[model samples]
Target chain A: MNDLIQTGKYLLIISAIAGLLLAFTEMVTAPRIAENNRLVLEKARREVLPGAERFDTLDLATTDDAGHPATRSLSLGFDAQGKFLGTVQTVSPKGYGGPIDIVLGLKPDGAVSGVKIQSMRETPGLGTKLAEGFLDKFLEVARAGHPVKFFVKKDGGDIDAITAATISSRAFCKGIRDGIKVVQEGQTLIQQRAAAPGATPLPGPATTPVAPSPAPAPAPAPVVPPAPSVPPAPPADPESPPPAPTVAPEPPAPPLPPAIPQGGGQ
Target chain B: MNTKELTKGIWAENPIFVIMLGCCPALAVSTSLANAFGMGIAATFVLLGSNLIISLIRASVPDKIRIPVYIVVIATFVTMIDKFMAAFTPALSASLGIFIPLIVVNCIILGRAEAFANKNTPQDSILDAIGMGLGFTIALAMIAVFREVLGDGKFFGIPVPLIKDDPCLLMIMAPGGFFVFGLLMAWKKHLAAGGAK
Candidate 1:
């Protein structure tokens, strides 16, 4: 009937008007939403690299070992002075319940500057505790200035995994280690590509570190020093004696794990 | 236009407590009164807009695609609200998280469109939406006040007079949401039944 056609026309007009109103709203909010996301990412950038006046981005390709997840080129951020700040990689690890997204700040020397939880979906008050001060423990151990490259106390890492939330803790630790590995892999790939006939040799720190090994503190499991464990300073005039003899061991904990010079002298 | 429908929305047909329409926010943002207020206003705006649009086109919409049409209208509004909040109220937006975008799916807006707008005139639908949205906002605000006062020992981050002395940590948890909703529902039903006498 003609009435049915008129009804359809009205419906069409009404929906069109509604749709137009929504489109206008989307337009108004689009810029603001984008700014918000940028602000958040910037805040995380600041947390990971404190005193960073400005940040610069570098491209580094990353691929998983299984070859399933292939992200071409993670970003390496730097401060205003062009000093290497940290590589901003979305460290996605299988968290307690789901995926935990984190951004890791790696110093030029390979030690972590800081780690920020970008996003996560874990049980509150339980697994969520992993987001609390858990990453800070890794940072504290890293204040010694190195990456978290091993396991928990029970398994033998420098970090204290959250009590009762081992899964969340491990998830965070693994995210950093793996993210670092990806960057390393990318750097190698770039270096190799540069050596090729058509490529420009990339200028970067040689992956091979050349230095002496730093002394690791007494780990409960292995009381033996990983290198030269400095003997406790004598109680008398500790500062006056000066711990300069330990200097040969103090500078190599992070980058020299593989590149320590032959020192039968130790 | 009439008081029956209007009063029904305020209590008998309450969108949240009795009907439990927007439960996502009920459980999600009730941790703090500020967050709850933000969510309540967002939902109310969506409800008001959708109700008006649906009622304006009620006669013309084909039954087959009415739901889809309603969804589009709701989603558009939600996206707008989401962007605005992100830009202007960054802190509250972060606390609210994804619930803002998820407002498109809040059952209260769609429920009102289908149940009331489809049968009512524009003015009546508008009134119904306003009354029901206000009711939903009040319910969420009440739950949020209780949780924030007990759980954090404060109101809107200001230390409550005596709550800080003995705060209840339980009110801020997921279980607290269920407890508040259940208690409020029971109390509302009791009052309605007793008033009938």
Candidate 2:
């Protein structure tokens, strides 16, 4: 009886100490972790909706495909002049392996300006192609105009599948199509938010929105590659070819895509 | 500090190659040099902290409740380090992803607590912790070098000439991790057997 009591005391003491230490660590890291997450979200916003100098998040209560009530949020982007640029939103489409998280930037006309895969669990070397040249092909099809079938060529759509990764390709298309629909639905709300005066400063870099020129094709101005030490300007070459699509490799290794800024940026 | 405790883990009884305690993470993160270093350092921090605490309380921890006590201590350290890394080193945190949280279950840590720190002095335990941590880091780096260079055709993210354009994709996959891990284990065993004499 005495040994049992003693053992109970020992366990209680150890757990209490462990809990206290964890609480202390949480106190210290909570703020910084929050800040880091904000920065990451901001960066993703900029990457998707290039030239978006200010953003307003709109919570949209809508319905899913199953007609269930789903609340979705949209980050409406505006230029330095407070001119509406487009909307950047994230959507998860069911893929072969699992849900494929994709962030998309759309022009005012509902054309896809940029596409980035936030995360996915697809087969490597195959489904992973959604992050490489396949995205470029996707953007081309998107810019071709609305009424896109949003299916693999095999499924009677315009976009080409990543060879054998047809399901992943199909999922990518579905995510874009869904994101575009969200933006279209929330267009009025986005314009209202943009019209509100005294909007907050842009996320990170102070670079003002480039060229308010009226062009249907908003340059997918790649977020200046998060290198503050170097001059923000890229060498002016007429034919450098748009930067290669961010490489998202397969699982078990290099799950990170080069698009992600390394520790230096962090 | 005893030299044997400090040095044995580095080569003679490497946690991965010989003792073979935490091969899951070793193989998963060995796909890239950067990932290997990130995981190694994070695990080392957890190992060092847990070993010290376990050693200090080893005597008082009743044999019946020792395993639970060790787990509480190990988990505390892992969560603390995981939170710190995520807060201060977001890039490394992002790169390592789920592996950091998973360190709570890494056998090398609990293995050391039960096998070495439980009966060892605090001072010797510290030395053992450092040695074993270094062993884990070196072994991970060795695996990462082959996997990244051969599989990805790159070294530390920089493209290697000739290999960069057409790297062997298979090398960066799970089969590749197993292949490199097996070959490296065999080589380590061969060396331990003194050139297979």
Candidate 3:
């Protein structure tokens, strides 16, 4: 019993010292660690929303397709003259390995401006192809103002899923679709804030009415003129105008109906 | 202080080969040269720090609770390196992943603390750490180079033409690690035997 008490005292002293040392180290490194994280997020934002002169964090509430609240915020991109360019949203959808965090930039009219994968634990060579080849297709469809489809050719959608990484590919598509839904649901409020400069858009309380019908059709027109103007100026542009139109209507093709059921069952 | 304590870990008491300590990380992170080197350096930092501290406090630590005290000391250093890596070298930190934290449980560290540090002077303990750490790093690098060149057909991500185009993919997988580790161990044993003769 005497020896036990002595051992207990020694253990307590060592643990207390260890705890104090760790606390000191944490205090010293916390700020720098936070700064590193912010820099990574900032770089991802810039990559996703290229050509934006500046970015502003907009406090906007987002909801899922089921109208349940989802945690997402919009980063508003503006040109040199403060013209509203587009918005960047972060979405994490369930991927094969784990949650794949994607940073998506969308034009005010619901087109994809760009996509940058922020973080993912997908298989090194296979699922990781989503960052390399697979993302380009989504960017192409979004640039053309087409509804995004989230499946591969085997499932009857336009996307050629990553070889042997169909699940990861589908997860990528799901994240993109979820992001687009957020932009669509919050479109009216975003446009209102964009049009009325200096107006603080309050986070609406529960049951914020889905804007009345016919809003989606007219919303694309004003945003469309600016979209074409920026892409054509450089002759070096890879995604030229002609191919976009041909691919734009493909998302609305019969493949979508069959793809939905297959994705659901899987 | 005796120079034998420092020189022994380099060859005779080599951590990975002869001593055969800390093999879990040796196999797991040895897939890439860069990853292997990073794990090596992080482990070295923890080993050196823990050994020095344990040596300094060896007299005061009671035999009845020495293991717990040593663990607390080692864990403190591991946490420090883990945070420092995350802040300064985020990419390396991400690639090394769980192995960085696992350094706390690495047997080479605790073994040294028990075998060498507890009985040695601080200066001797520091040298032992440096020698053992370098041996571990070199061993891991050797294994990494073989695996990477054969498995991925790349030496540090630079593709070799014939091998890169058609390489044995198994070298980067779990079975590949075991194969290389066994071969390397046998080769080291052969070299030691020849040297002795």
* TM-score to true structure, per model: 0.63, 0.71, 0.70
Q: What value of lDDT does candidate 2 attain over all alpha carbons?
A: 0.71
Runs of candidate 1 with Cα error greater than 4 angstroms are A1-36, A72-82, A92-101, A109-112, A115-208, A211-266, B1-12, B63-65, B83-97, B148-171, B195-197
Q: Residues B129-189, candidate 3: write the lDDT tens digits.
A: 9989988988889889988898868887788889988778688766788899999998889
Docking class of 2: acceptable
Clashing pairs in 1: A60-A73, A60-A74, A61-A73, A142-A145
Report the poorest 10 consecutive residues by lDDT, candidate 2 chain A: A257-266
Candidate 2 lDDT by residue in tens digits, A46-133 = 9888888777665655557775657677776776666667778889999976898888887665557788877676653446557766
lDDT of 1 by residue, A188-261 (tens): 32222222212222234543333434433211322112233222332122222333343324422442233211
* Candidate 2 residue-wise lDDT at A241: 24
Over the stretch B85-170, how does candidate 1's per-residue lDDT look in tens digits? 77788886655544555466678988998888988998888888888887887888888888889876879768898888887877
Task: Supply the TM-score for candidate 2.
Answer: 0.71
Question: Can you list the residue pairs that collide in candidate 2?
Answer: none
**What are the DockQ scores of the candidates, in order?**
0.32, 0.29, 0.37
Residue A236 miss distance in model 3 (angstroms):
33
Q: In lDDT terms, which candidate is top?
A: 2
CA shift at A172, candidate 2, in angstroms?
6.9
Backbone clashes in each candidate structure, one number apiece?
A: 4, 0, 1
Candidate 2 structure quality by residue, lDDT tens digits, B1-197: 48999999899988999999998778767877777887788788788998999999999999999999999988887888788988999887765544665476689999999999999999999988888999999999999899889987889878899998988877777788899999999999888788957
Candidate 3 local lDDT, A1-266, one digit each (tens): 99899888989988998899899889888888889877888888878777776666544454544655444677777555555677898888899868888988876555677888877867544576687657876567546534544556676665778755789888887787777665554454445434333223322221122434443332222222222221112112233222233222322111111111112122
Which of the numbered candidates is closest to the native, going by highest TM-score?
2
